[model samples]
Target: MTITSPSSEAPDWPQCAHEADGRRCRGRPVEPYAACLAHIGVDRRAGHLAALEPGAGLDLRGTPFTRDLLTELLAALTDPATGRHRLGPADFEEAEFSGDAQFARVDFTGDVSFDGAAFGGGAYFTGARFEADLGFVGATVARNVWLDGVECGGGVCFNKTRIDGELRLETGTITKSAVFRGLVVGGDATFSGIEFIEPAVFMETEINGTAWFDGALFRSDVRFDGARIAGKAWFDGAEFHHDARFDSATLSEDVSFNGTRFVEGAAFPGATIGGDVEFGGNEIGGDVTFRKATFQRTTVLGPLVFPRLLDLSDAEFQSAVTIEAAVGTLHCRRTRWSSTAALRLRHAEVDVSDAVLQFPVSIAGRSHPFVADGRELEVPELSDAPVRVASLRGADAAHLVLTDVDLTGCQFVETVHLDQLRLDGRCPLASPPPGLRRIGRRPVRWTRRRTLAEEHHWRAERQGADGWTRAPGNTDVWGPAALAPVYRQLRKALEDGKDEPGAADFYYGEMEMRRLDPDTPPGERALLALYWAASGYGLRATRALGWLLLAVVATVLAMMLWGLPQDDPEPVSTGTVTGSRVTMTTDKPDPVNPQGSYGSRLSSERFEKSLRVVINSVVFRSSGQELTTAGTYVEMASRVAEPALLGLAVLAVRSRVKR
Candidate 1:
């Protein structure tokens, strides 16, 4: 067939346009192109490559071909090797594979475009170099695709492409933007160690197998928005120099971001994770958000350093959620907690001044509470559901809002953010987790103790106290003005729950704080002091018992010392004297009978007589023969006090314990 340039003015035969070494190429031109075969044109290279096959396989490097050569190229590449050298890879460089054609690899040196191409075989482009743009729009690869160690001077794209097998693009360098929107991968895909100088987009993509981006570096923004991963996804050791996003994505299996670094920001808003998600040991420099996202399984974030902020507003945790280390502002307003355990925060500090730290978590499951601070104390009416415990331990938080929280089966360790906290439902009582040791590492403690000194220290610090100053009788750090409201709120919560004993505990705290309050009225302070000393505000039954025991012992000792009280000496007539040396005389006949009444309520010790006097003094009963005197009245008051203490103890104990 006659070959000619695609021009109406050309004759049936057209000469080549390229010349080398001062001689022109005598080859005919290919249609629709200016250059002829053997002169930097497609037809010459295509026809030549179609005819020549090495002893083993096709070994045509630097051979230019056109879209018509796509099928023949695949056939030649798939053919079995015959000779040893022929088994080598088919090479193409400075060749035009044309638009709408795709291959795996070559030491490419010129522009290449596979726009709107289809491939029935693998797409392995390992160690390829491109001086110009490498496009793959509207392409399809039926088998595995590999693009390792590629270096591109221009931009790259895989837009609207579909692949039936794995696709790897690791260890590549693209000077310009790389786009992969609407792409689909059937098998495992990797983009590790890649450097995208400009932005990289993977929006609206779908991956059916595992996706690995380990050690990948993005110099510009990278986005995976609206993508879906049906299998596991890993981003280990990846570094995003610019903002990285996975917003609105769906992950069906476990995803990990171990040792990853985000220089700008990372976002996953409105995303859904069906399996576990962990970002252990990651350093996120900018704000990281998971707003309105849903986690179906365990979500673990630890050793993560977010320098700016962390926003989790309205996020839902169906399972357990843990934050081990976060050093930035934590915005967790209006979060929904559906997990059967409390939210756990360990070794995290959220001290940002302008952040929204309200923990208005809406509890969902019956097994879990809204939040917990690893300290445990048992209370009544606890749930019997298997312990699904969650806790936030070793964290310093401020301006917190903990409304409608239930800490029935939860514990907190080193968490000190209860001050100025907003509340709503069952005020999160610091009671022991329910059903001890049944679930979630919740501990059960039966003994009560004084408030911890460190806890108070932190409280004082938050209250703007410069130094530690214990209350008059208690070790509370916050003065009455700062802590009285908290105590009252807690008391009201317990009272609303009809837990009088619990309310009394808080009431005791309130009175204790008020008693030491410098601003309190002097009369009120005195009254509060008296109340505390007397009944410990109706909470310290044990203290009242101690006082009763002390009173009983002390009264007994006093009775022994006083011996017996004798009726005022019987009146006897005597003479008066004029001076200091004067003397008087009296008759001795009235005391002649020893068995007669002595007019003194004295009893002997043999029949426990002294014991009788002691018992009378303790019971506040008169021993008879008492000629009224101020001394006798004091004894009577002492006798009444011991029994009152005993009664107080009994009442206090009965109110709390179900006998």
Candidate 2:
């Protein structure tokens, strides 16, 4: 490729300026208008007369013409006629632009060819309508080119054209096809609102600056193969009726397809993006492919309504990416994902069918937690660091393999399948599924303290006690019963503070006590009685009441008998009768007046009556005396051993007190 010099400094020049005067030329003209006026179509060339024509136009509407006719007509019109030149089927096969020229509003009837033409100035084709076809194959432009509203009945080809300025195709409607294959532009280009009625091609077109296609509508297929865009490209509201191809292209800046709708598939195989790429709020009715593309920064395709596939096979993102609320299949096959900053994936419904998360290894002093569904995760290995998770709320997984996974404070609600080989936490089961097996081959042991409710439940259910003596429950069929010996032993253990409520040691003692003897020791007999009374045992309560009453009465009577000597007289008192002055005395104290002093021996009747009254009031007519202390029981037991001696002692004290 020879490096062409700038147009102004080039030495060889064949140029003709636009005609100003309608008169003849001043110098030696190449072909004078006076001599060529008859041959140049006198009627159509009358309006724009005295102006040098561009070239003869061609027409190939219903006829097949040779290449020589197009060449001859172009040669004849190069002599600078001072009027507009028009060519139809007379010159359709071949045409060239060897010198700098202008052909505004020239018609072409067939496929007009300019295979190797070089233009130094702007190629102005504004409103130059072509009925059949047009071609500027491999044309080169050193400056700007304009094709504003230039309608073509068939495809207009510009396979490789280099334009330095803007190429305007705004409002142009092509009937059959359009091509700008391998066209290179040194400046910006505009194709805004251009309607391609047929298929359009911009295959391998390199734009150095912004390429505007804002509102361009493609009714058929469009191709952009191997193009390199150095600046931002805008496709703000474009609509593609068929597939759009941008295979092997490179975008050095941000590219946007905001609100663009693709009716068919869009492919971008082997493309590289250097900056942020956004496709916000676009709708793709077919599949969109970005296979093997490298994104250097953040890429966003948020809030898109995709009706088909979104493939990102073999694509690498050096930074982060987010594809939020995309309602379609998301395939991220063998892609390297990371972030220079933080990467967040909140509130996105991800459908990972066969995705491989090629998680990058963490550098020194960095943290990375790998989290993906086991079925969706395609990595053959795993990380060794701790995985910090906020919560795993209702995630479904048949197999969860975490090799050396550190979960410091993780809570498990529903039943988690136990691992066959485990380490660090004491799981109750020994073996489970293969996927649940831990990396290490040791048992994981963990001890947890039970809450109050948990302790009560386990004790009443697992270890049966009196507290659980209600109607048998569903679990009580295999559970232990409330036995007295077990209750006593458990209470003793609890009082000694040697056992916690739910410890295994406490339960072991209770189980052992269930086989012990039922007869309690005499010191604990009172405790047994109190227990029966407190629990409202009616039969046991009656028995305990009778024994307690006998014990207390025996204790009080014995104490009173011991207080008197072996010859002690019973207490007595003397009083005067109301009618006669007489001292009344008895051998026993009056039951109602036992606190008075004894006076003298009285009649046998009085003495006998006093003794009977004392006996009835103190012993026979009363319920029983109250036992206030342990000594009272001991005294009563001793009195029961010798009841005859106690009766004699009481009678002697009564006789002595009366005398």
Q: Point to the candidate with the largest lDDT.
A: 1
Provide TM-scores for the models: 0.55, 0.45
Judged by lDDT against the true structure, how good is candidate 2? 0.48
Q: Report the error of model 1 at residue 88, Å.
A: 25
lDDT of 2 at 337: 56
Candidate 1 is scored at a TM of 0.55
**Residue 340 of model 2: what lDDT?**
30
Q: Evaluate all candidate structures by whole-model CA lDDT and list the values in order.
A: 0.57, 0.48
Tens digit of per-residue lDDT, candidate 1, span 1-659: 11111222422345557666664433344444546533544565576556644322232222234555555545543434421111222222222333333444443444565544445566667766665677777666667778888888878888888788999888989988999999899998898888888999988889999988888888999999999998998988889999898889998888888778888878999998877766665666678888888888855644344445667676777775654433334555455555433334322223222222334332222223222134221212222322222233322233333433344322233344533233443434443222333213434322242232332443344443333322334333434565565566555655654666656666665676688678999999998887677777656698888887777655544443343333324646588778776667775332111122433233444125335554566564665423224335546766678677877888878767732
